[model samples]
Target: MRRPTSGCSTGSRRPWNGLGLLLVLLLAGCGGDGGRQTPPPEVGVPPSLREDAGPPVQVVRLDERQAAELSVRTARVRAALAPYTLSLPGEVLPAPDHYAVVSAPISGRVARIYAHEGEAVRPGQVLLELESLEFANLAADYLQARADATYLEERVARLRTLVEKQISPRSTLDKAEADLARARAGVGAAFARLKALGLSDATIEGWSSTDRERPLLPVTAPIGGVIDQHRVDLGRSVTAYDEMLTLIDPARVLVRGFVPPEEAAFVQVGDTVEVGPRSASAHPLTGRIATINPALDEANRAVVVNALMPTREGWPRPGQTVNLRIRTGTPRPVIAVPLAAVTYDGEQPVVFVRTAPATFEKRPITLERIGPEEAVVTAGLADGEEVAVSQVFSLKALSRFEQYAEE
Candidate 1:
């Protein structure tokens, strides 16, 4: 057997069976490169452990068509003298001296109403007429006192003549004089009472005892205004000092602005203010701050600032809600941008700055103040830089998507 032909002979020719071939492959894999030792399969770096990498810059690139489809608009940043403005909630109100409460001067029943609610009235315009027995009695007393005064005067003159002709004693003339003086005082007292009852001197002077018509107390407007409220109707009874009508002069109106207590110090009398309806599209009226209340409103803890402005017909009617923009300080040069150009990212205010024709870079900024239409930039922007004023939301979305793709 040729030394049993060495069952494990280094074969001159041996066919590789399936099991032998598999064993050879296993040995070669375990030994690897004949002890030259392959580098541990070149371990890859994880994303978290990658070196020399930073957060991707937020940027959005679009073609002209995409921008146009989004209605993107741009405005250039500029150094402008934008006055600091404080916006406040406000109400349209009648000026203090231009508003009045018409009240009954005497206890009476409403005989007639001449002015209706919302009717315009002028000073001295009769608003209503009241039928009062008390007024009639007053008229009667005045007439009687006047008649007595006339009789006493005639008696005094007759007595004077009689005394001068020696037909009457001098004592008689003196007694007549005393009576005339008393009667004159009574007449004066009655006249004062009539005057106190809202009767003008001319009105009293025109009245005569022979007139059989009953006297009606006329209630007149003391100021030019619109009748805002009517509290009495025909035949309604009212007492003295009872409110019967409310009048407000719409032409002389005020904007009562409620400013936050923290910002009160920035407001001053004589500062320019713009008052308008709460709607932004409505035209605004310019005015100056006339007064500021020393105390805060108890309900809202806000300082009350009154602005005096010229009136426009049918606008800014009393009790209408309004917006007040108070220019607190003089205009100073600052980097400014339109309010539409600003947006927020996780509470961080940001703006889309146009770096190229269709490229925008999201930039964080610090704001000194923000007004209704514009904002003052304190940092992160330069004068003459352009920013996206419209379609900023679409740009922000694109920026976020780009960041995701880069990651």
Candidate 2:
């Protein structure tokens, strides 16, 4: 074999070096990742993040036969005159004219309490009894006065008889008559005192010396109502001016609300308003505006409105929070549908808009206001679109059932 020359050896090493360099480059490219890759063009974020949402596709498809079986009815949405309503927070309050404050007529100890807080009472019903020595003294004094008057009348009669028979002096007869008049005046004063103490004429007349019962002053209710509060307890001492109890007639209540200054001009006395409890589902209490305060509240710049609301028995208690719905603005043309056509889907008010025969799509609606039987749609509905009205509950049930099935 011929020895390799220096130039050939160096040239051979150079080819090896080139091959090694190529291998190193390939190894780096394929290190952990299989091959080199250009970072992909940033595909933009998710569609939901962009907030471009399409119309809801909640469809309830049914054949004509199925629709007939469900008895689902539809009505065309039409423009109708609708009143503008404003709902304001309000409070149920006792009508001032229908409330009574029971105060102690005389200073005494509370012997008994016949009615308690929240108990119904009738007019003239005894609510409390007071053991008053002062009342007994007055009764005793009246009796004494009456006895003295009777005695003097008899004496005067005798004196008159004597004078007519010429057995007594005329001056003596006159003195007897004067004494009788004075005694009679004393009796009258006593009777007036008893009357001032709230004693009936019959009661004053019925008192006799032989009576065994003490002169107990019975505090009676002046009006029929529920006892709203009791300030005195049994055996508690009370004064003449002390408030004993407060009574309120729940049937006669006022729905009191304050309207914004902008709305104050629209409120008028005798306007019908609907009052309902804030949290209760019962039917609204119907009433008429009884008064609108001429002055505005200094703090809130609102005008006070009072509505005379007739409530059910023992309902709409005083101080209860409520909502007062007042229709103020003139009627305007609006897209309206039957209230039955609307239903709630997880707090969203929606109506089924008919797309095709026996095919309905649930669409959300923005309501301007809702009345007892109709709803005015401000948006999300068209003028002539047909909406499911009758049997809407059945349709809603079916829709919910289908949604669960799909899930």
Candidate 3:
């Protein structure tokens, strides 16, 4: 009985004790029910690792009331021709033929000023009068020469008649003819001198030997313009060729743009250019390049480009600094939007594209060029898409906030 059959014996098995029964129960529990496998311990997984996770949300939603409060306005992206532009500093100048410097034709004292600075004058209008002794001498000489010519002409006529009538010697007639020629030459020389002193041919033709009035030289305007500078006062003594007044026609102007030497190749004669004041609010004037200096400026090494301005009233006065935008390359078709519709995200330009009435997708864009009114988008945008032109900053803020909230 002590060596009795064990629980594991192949013969008749003995009934198990309490300890053996407990061990069997423990082993059965470890093996699971009916030899079925017991699963491993459960583990927690991140939401990102889940098979059902969706892509990141890139859209920003707004209610009608919110959008209205922000004054959000949208514009459709448009296909347009965008030309490359080069910006340069420029100066407003008087057109070459429309400007003049009035100077003294003879040494004289300024007797009168008919046109003051800033006064507009017409062509051939007397701008000033000069009192000079030299003019008096010239007038006297001219009168004397005319008198001698008349006297010699009468003598020649009388002598020719006498010689033809055989009442005077041929030698005497010849001598009289030579004297008349000399007198005519003297007259011509004196007339030239009077004309050189700024006297018109009409005035010279009208002068007589009997007239004793003091000769006054009238300085006339060669062009129609406003007197921009007056350097002489009444009774001021000036010499020949001395500058007395400066005149400029503001209606006809030129914008001279100074371009960098490297950029000169893109500019050519007849290219359209826009000129305006330095203030952004000023309306720009359009013109075509009239000339491009082949040589660079020695001082600044900049190429000089000139554009003739169309006649306009009261703008772009001479000596005024201006802004010049030269359209360089040929324009190409591109998708464009208002400048206000674009915003920056950490230096990355982005635009909010309206996918629905209340939803916008923030999309990055590749800008080919940005102009004063619009930006040319080379990539990441399509024509006919609507973008928020107003309140873009608000949309950017909302996008950032939503992004953080999602994180």
TM-score of each: 0.61, 0.57, 0.62
Sort by lDDT, best first: what order? Answer: 1, 3, 2
lDDT of 3 by residue, 1-407 (tens): 37755644844443456668889899989878768867999997876788898534478899888867886788987776655688889888889888999889999999988889989999999988999998888888888988999999999899989989999999998998898899899999999998887678998999877777777889999899899989999999999999999999888888889988755765779898998889783568988999998898887789999999965568878889999999865245778778898999889899999998888999998986666677778888998999998889989999999999988
- How well does candidate 2 score on lDDT at residue 87? 78
lDDT (CA) per prediction: 0.86, 0.83, 0.85
On the 0 to 100 scale, the lDDT of residue 336 in model 1 is 79
Worst 10 residues of 2 by lDDT: 47-56
Give candidate 2 misplaced runs (Cα > 4 Å): 1-83, 279-282, 298-300, 329-407
Q: What is the lDDT of residue 158 in candidate 1?
A: 90
Query: lDDT, candidate 2, residue 113?
Result: 84
Clashes of each: 0, 0, 0
lDDT of 2 by residue, 1-407 (tens): 98769988898799889999999998887894776667889988765466686654688888778887876788998776655567788888788878999998888899988899999999989998999888888888889988988898899899989999999999998988888898889888989987876777998888886788866898888899889889899999988779999998777887788888765755678777888877755678787788898898777678989888777866688878888888664346789788889998888799999998888888989986666667778899988999988777777777888888877
Off by over 4 Å in 1: 1-83, 162-171, 330-407
